[model samples]
Target chain A: MSKTILIVGGGLAGTIVANGICRQMGAELRSGALNITMLGTSETHMYQPGLLYIPFGRMREAELFRDQRKVLDKRVNFFVDPAKAIDVEKNQVTTEAGRTFKYDYMVLATGSRIMPQTIPGMKEGGHWFYDLDGARKLRTALNEFKGGKIVINVNAPHKCPVAPLEVAFMLHDYLKAKGLWDKAELTYTYPIGRLHALEPVAHWAKPEFEKLGIKYETFFNTESVDPQAKTIKSMEGSELPYDLLITIPPHQGAQVIDDSGLGKGGWVPTNTKTLHREGSANVFVVGDTTNIPISKAGSTAHFEADVTIDNLVSLCQENTFAREYDGKVFCFVETGLGSGTYVWFNYTTPPNPGPPSQMIHWFKLAYNRLYWLSARGLL
Target chain B: MAERQKIDARGAFCPGPLMELIAALKLASIGDEVDVWSSDKGSASDIPAWCAKVGHSVVEASEHDGYWSVVVRKAK
Candidate 1:
């Protein structure tokens, strides 16, 4: 009998794992020795890195979306439904639509969700560039701005650790292009003590931030935002006034993981090296859903997929996972004006970012195209 | 000189130039050439790579004045 492997979440990690496994186990899949099914909430897959280009008008919204069906391989079964709960004891999952799936093995790649409402007045008062709608709104607001204090504030545990810095750098270029650089005061505030979570990246970015005249405020735990007053207060009672506010809101794992009691603090706990869920033998987790103590960026998902697929193949064959994930992460940080930097690191090595250059920027752009091919297991 | 269509994708980011070349190739007749002018450094190599994958032919790829111009012909 064929063993069923059900994957939850069809985002970058889920799709990549599905396609990777299908390609590697083609004969098994064709011979009905292995069965695969992917469950997702929607048919649309958004190329999230394109969200970074929206504020700069470098990419259009239409270019960022593709049919998820087109991206997944034909050998993998896909369902458009949200997973509701996981019964780890029974090796089964239930969906919101009352459908239940039994599996021999399961993979969770549900990613993360942004909670803007967690902060007072944030939804109405501030804008973000992480989502398509927010980016479009910010683009319009940025285009219509005359000149004043522009603040980029970040809440903790957000996705894409370098996004706030990228926004700051791009905003500087945007203002300079409009001849309003001197008229606008750019400030970036983070809950962390350093400008970046990664020390090496912070070191390289400090001088660049100085050159762009962007003020960095660290240890800024957000207390609340007074949208009417156009000011944000830190937990320490300090206040910063702003004419425009762009916020990276708090992020949490999917509610299903929490509801199923598979997660604590809204995140699934998995072995950093083994990529297996804590206390679950046949369950594996990847992407932002797992509390992996790394930047919750797409590159992290891409790298984790490699380890997960390798281990999953071993599990299907030998009833044991054989591979260990190194926690390798690669990120392309856009510094604006057709230039960017590359950050590469793993569990053992800290990030050693190279100087910003146009070539890295182009590589990042090329990645957007290659990502689709990658989703189809073609690249 | 053979008739060639020019796509000025200069200053556009990666995949943008490649997408433009693909779109132009769709409109061109077999054997007609499309030239893409891109300031993005990746275009010089990416366009050729894409052409090779999809059965198109890259005729001439050259650099000039802060940008790259790549000429591709629709093979089929």
Candidate 2:
């Protein structure tokens, strides 16, 4: 009997898993003993991390996308139909196109999305760079601005932990280059008491903020944005007036996870080590879809995808797991226009960021191009 | 008999070399040495740390012109 593997979501995690398992399980696939299928929402796969450079005009928009079919292994039975519901007990997934897929083993990689509309009046007032449309709008806004008070507001559970900091640093450099630095007063606001969720990163950023004379307001949870009044109010009783408002909006997992009643807020409760859905031995959860308290960065998804690939192959071939995911995450942090540093940490070790340098920045640029290879599981 | 395998992972960045070493060790026999050559500075320490956590033994580690080579013996 042949074993069927169904993967939901064709993003980073799912793509890597689909490509990787195909690479390792070639004989099984050829002999008609294994089936791998992927369901996605689109034909184009966007490199989301490249969206950061879009607002700054540092990277071309075309450089951030690839044809999804060309990137995946030819053996995968791919579909552009998005998942509507996943019934774990039935071991089945239903798609928005009114089709059903039954699997021997399933992988849920349905990633998260930004929900700026959740914040009252924010969708109308604020500018964000998390998506392509938002980034293009922000580019025009930044390019046309003369200078004034600019507020960089951050919300929790957002992907790419260092992005807010990176944009702030890059914005400062941009203003300086345009001779608008002195005219512009940049203020950063975070809901937490520090600059970042990670303690070491907060400690590192404070001095850099001070050196650059960037003012910050800690504990400023957003209450509402009054576009008419040109002011934003916080739940902590702080009101900030701004000429330009840039925000990192809050995030939520895919709607299908909630519709299926698998877990609250679209995140499935997952076994941190084994990457399995809670109470379901045959179901796996990967990347941002798992309710694992960690950065929702691309590296997190890539690492988890690799683990899932290895385990799924082992289970199909040997009725066992190959290894466990060790909670590993690696991310590169851009400090300025020309310098960067990186952090690598697991469940046990805390990340220690080194001094930013031009070499690491170059490496980041190179990696940006190599992301296609990474998605294909060749890297 | 113990055997030696070499992997040239000189340009791979953080976690890249470590992941490659793990993949190689899985295919090697017990007491086999997998020498990982890495230009990433973090790997000299990271490879050994991973070995320690996963019950593998690092026989020797040394630095060359611009890279480091760490030899590990798969214990399991």
Candidate 3:
């Protein structure tokens, strides 16, 4: 009997998992002993990290996308179908097109999405860069601005933990380059009491922010935005007025997750070490959809995908599981257009961000291009 | 004499080189040495630290040209 692996979500994690598995299980696939299939919403894959550069005009729109088919292995069966429901009890996934896929093993990589609508008035009063349309609109908003109070409001449980700070720093440099640094007042608000969830990063950013004269407000959970008044109200009873409001709105897992009764808020309960969907031996979770208390960055997804591939290969070929996933995450943070730094940590270790340098900035840019290779499991 | 294996991982980014080193070390004899050539700046510190934590020894680590060559010997 052939082993079938059904992967949901065609984003970074699913693609990587499919390609990585194919890289090792080619003989089995050719012999018809194994089948790897992926269900995705679109045929095009977007490099999400590139969204950070979009609002600032740092990257061309063409550079962020590639046809998903070209990136995946030729042996894998790829479908441009979205998963509508997941039945873990029966080990089957039903797609939006009314097709049900049964599998020996299943991978849930149905990443997260922003829920600006969850907050009152946020949909109308605020601008975001988490998606392509939002980034383009924000670009236009930045271009037309003469300069005034700019509030960068950050919400919790968003992917890419450092992006809010990265955008703030980049915006500072962007304003400076446009000769509007003095004309604009930048203020950042976070839901937490600290500048960052990571204490060390909060310490690192505080000095950098102070040096740039960027102001910040902590413990400000977003309650609503009043476009009519050009003000944002926080649940803590603080209201901030802005000429322009850029926000990192809170995120939730894909609606299919909640609809399928898999998890609340679209997040699947997953074992942190094993990457297994809680209580489902053959079901694994990866990427933003998993309810792991870690930074939901692409690197985290990539690392998790790598471990899934290893264990799946062992299970398919040897009838035994392989290594456990070390809770690992890495992220490159840009201090400005020219300088950047990175942090890497596992379950046992905390990240200590190094000093910013231009070389690291170059590496980040290079990685932006090198991401395709990484997705193919070649790097 | 301990057998030595060479890995040229200069162009790969962080974790890439380190992952390759770990894979190589797994296939190596207990007394064998693995020399990794990595251009990633983090490898300088990450390789040595990973070696120490995992009970491997860093036989030599030095910079040459644009990359650094770190040598590790499997202990167990």
Model 1 C-alpha lDDT per residue in residues A25-48, reported as the tens digit of each score: 988998999999999989999988
The parts of candidate 1 lying over 4 Å away from their true place are B1-76
Off by over 4 Å in 3: B1-76
Per-candidate iRMS values, in order, are 21.0, 16.0, 16.6
Candidate 2: list runs displaced more than 4 Å: B1-76
Candidate 3: pairs in clash = none
Query: For candidate 2, what is the recovered fraction of reference interface contacts?
Result: 0.00
lDDT of each: 0.81, 0.86, 0.87
Candidate 3 Cα deviation (angstroms), residue B62:
50
Residue A163 in model 1: lDDT = 83
- Candidate 3 local accuracy as lDDT? 0.87
Tens digit per residue, CA lDDT, model 3, A226-345:
999999987657899999999998888899999999876788888878899989999999999886666788999999999999999999999998999888889999999999999888
Clash count, predicted structure 1: 0
